[model samples]
Target chain A: MDVKAEIIAILKDVTGLDDVGSDPAENLFADGVLDSMATVEVLVAMQDKFGIQVPVSEFDRNQWNTVNKMVDRVGELEEA
Target chain B: MHNITPYSSPTYFIYLLLLLSPIMIGLYNGKRFRVYETFATVIILITAFFGGNMSQGISLICYILFEMVLVLSYLRYRTKENSKNNFWVFFWSVILAIIPLVFVKIDPLLNNATISLFAFMGISYLTFKSVEMIMEIRDGAIKEVKPWEFIRFLLFFPTITSGPIDRFRRFQKDVLKVPSREEYVALLKTGTNRLMLGLLYKFIIGYIFGTLLLPKVSVLALSYQHQAPLGLSWWVLAYMYVYSMYLFFDFAGYSLFAVAISNFLGVKTPMNFNKPFKSHNIKDFWNRWHMTLSFWFRDFIYMRLMFFMMKKKLVKNRVTMANLGYLTLFLIMGFWHGETWFYIVYGLFHAGAMITNDAWLRFKKRHKKSIPSNKFTECFAIFLTFNVVCFSFLIFSGFLNTLWFS
Candidate 1:
């Protein structure tokens, strides 16, 4: 699966908000697609599926708030 | 020379209004006279501490210095190049921040024999702020930490006692910027209106319900405690509504005063209540009532619990996980209120209501065509929610325990 697609799917599934109009750069949090709860779900799902452990303590919503940013983060973490 | 809690009395408002004039003037003239603001804040804080309670004042000072060292050190650790952020460090920072509050809440449970020396007014709110800062620092959301700015945010007098808890970044934005003349004028108008409305709610309506009516209703209800039907009667119902009203008016009125004061100083603090009685369900009620505190819980507790459960794969079913989350969140909230069976039950009651409400919502969503949807139904939902919430308040009031046990 495409990383971006997977990221978007995880967010929608976690939040139960279908048809979230996703621009890769669009902010999920700011747009009300992902709240703090949904963000947790997304983070956990990412770890489970992608094996990327984004520490909650080090999670910056601003930097990882968009699908593209999240994808990039996963890519970077996976590489590391 | 009685030291009263902030905005507790009309005289406190008089003193506050007088003290705020220069700050208001400075903001209106496009100048944030930082020095004057600092001096005024000190005076008010001193009044809160020494005017009535010297012990609390000393406690407050100790609490501030302790939190300052912890936060500053945490910030430093976070910024270090190879610091390999340890979870224990973050955990301890948070634990230390709330240690004072933990003792304070537990003090009442120790047979009321020993008081927690760390107890002080606004300790819970301060702890909330400190914990948030630590989390932000760990997240690298707060890149730099200045001691004075951190202190200013912690000591921001408006909403200090009871907060519509402001976030550090959100508050920093307001603190660093001067509102335009037009904006400042609007803030003044809104602030004054809020202040007047708060006065009406707290002093007028709250006084009528809490002072004049509550005692009478309580006596009436107590007198009829054994009237059957589970220690309930018409008077108990009346007590429920009266107590709920008193709670709402008193807290909402206090919130308005806090927001108004923040606005007067050109800072727009968030609101705490949003017509909570109009909620259609228990979940909706939580969203509307004590909004900041609930949101804080949602962000810090519920969400985190959800993630932890899912990561550990502790609960297989999502619905069950959500239910557990609500239970955990409210139970903690209940315990936070005090170490009492009544408080715990009150928390469980809401958790049960919310879980049921969510199930109902899911059912309704699936059966939208069959389920009746109309103005009458909507009205009925509001009425049902209001009554249920009132009953919960009755439980929360501990009147049942008093009637049955005491």
Candidate 2:
């Protein structure tokens, strides 16, 4: 229902898992929500879902490394 | 139209280097030309279009048509939420792509299959890249793409010939941004090195090997008449394959140069080779060698053949039938290389070898409890596979494949 819940659902869908527990700091990749191409794929889905284009430069940056970080970044993109 | 012959005089070198001077000036003027990596190839296409003979013009048009498919796909993806039936669109695009190739290779007056295009169809590869994008879209793997990004992926001039066969999404990402300084330097250095190596391999090794081996082949055909030489016939045929191996490495080197430069310019063209020679078996070799091309065959033709066979109830036993599936796939692959009868046999030859190799692996698994594994056996199999590959190429282009069989 909240941003955190949405992020967890996204991660679960990506990883094809039943549950991703409620640690806002939980690692999506380590918890098997994603693999090596995780960051890019998640970032892409997020952009497509939200209809916002993250800056080309931000892709190489560390902002999309985690679910919380990515949500915050996407929120920023929307605001901007 | 501009001339497109690379086999012509050294004038193209002077022309290209001088032509690039203006683009460099445009870069200095802060133009937005840094948006794509295949920018360098635009110059070549321009040159060909301006001065290329009739055939070259035809090839150029085929190339543009391929670029158009990518353009259309990107636009449709942007506008539509869902396109479940994009498969047929891509299929027709492939058929359209080959029209130019057919017209160029066989004159329209003679060949009934001619599509009445002006020239040959060398741009089918670009069509493959575009078709892959459409497939990805149908699979719901990509949500959207930019127009320019799609153009860069399809028409990025550097890979216009003998491609490394890049994937759509990955290449789209690669071309979206400018290259960092370090990346640029690495790309420039590697690209130049490979370009030099390609020149040497093609001009020097290919020419020299052809000169040495071809005459001997002609002499044998002449002198021996009907008598088979000192049983040296097969060996000579094997030697005839030297040019093919040389040509592959040469073309591969050119592709590497093209892709590396594209990367340095902030475009991410996919790598085409992966130590193909070291593969222990035919299937493994296919996986490593010209991987993108093989994948193209798999996605467009092979998978369809397999599904078709299944649907037709043509395959009785699952395993044996599956081997037949692989057989048809590689044979189709061989034919795709060229349209000649030699290419047909070549494709069938590879299909047969790969099927036999797979059968042997299954056999080995069943007998694993009785026989211990040996490095020697594995190494021997690989060595033998290389010769088998070499021999297949001989049939693809040499006496037996062309004259004996046909």
Task: Name the best candidate (by DockQ).
Answer: 1
- Cα lDDT tens digits, model 2, B68-144, are 66546544754475545555665665566455555544553374755545443335576577666655554446557
Docking class of 1: acceptable
State the TM-score for model 1. Answer: 0.89
In model 1, pairs of residues that clash are B3-B51, B3-B52
lDDT of 1 by residue, B1-406 (tens): 7666899987888889899899899999999999999999999888888776488888888889989999999999999998777989988888988888888998876785555767778898988888888887887778887999989999999988889798888899999999999999999999999999999999999999999999999999888877867778789889999999999999999999999999999999989999999997787788789998997888667876787788778999888988889899999899888888899999999999988987887777567689998999999999999998999998899999988888
**TM-score of candidate 2 versus the correct structure, residues matched by position:** 0.69
Best by lDDT: 1
Model 2 chain A weakest 10-residue run by lDDT: A32-41
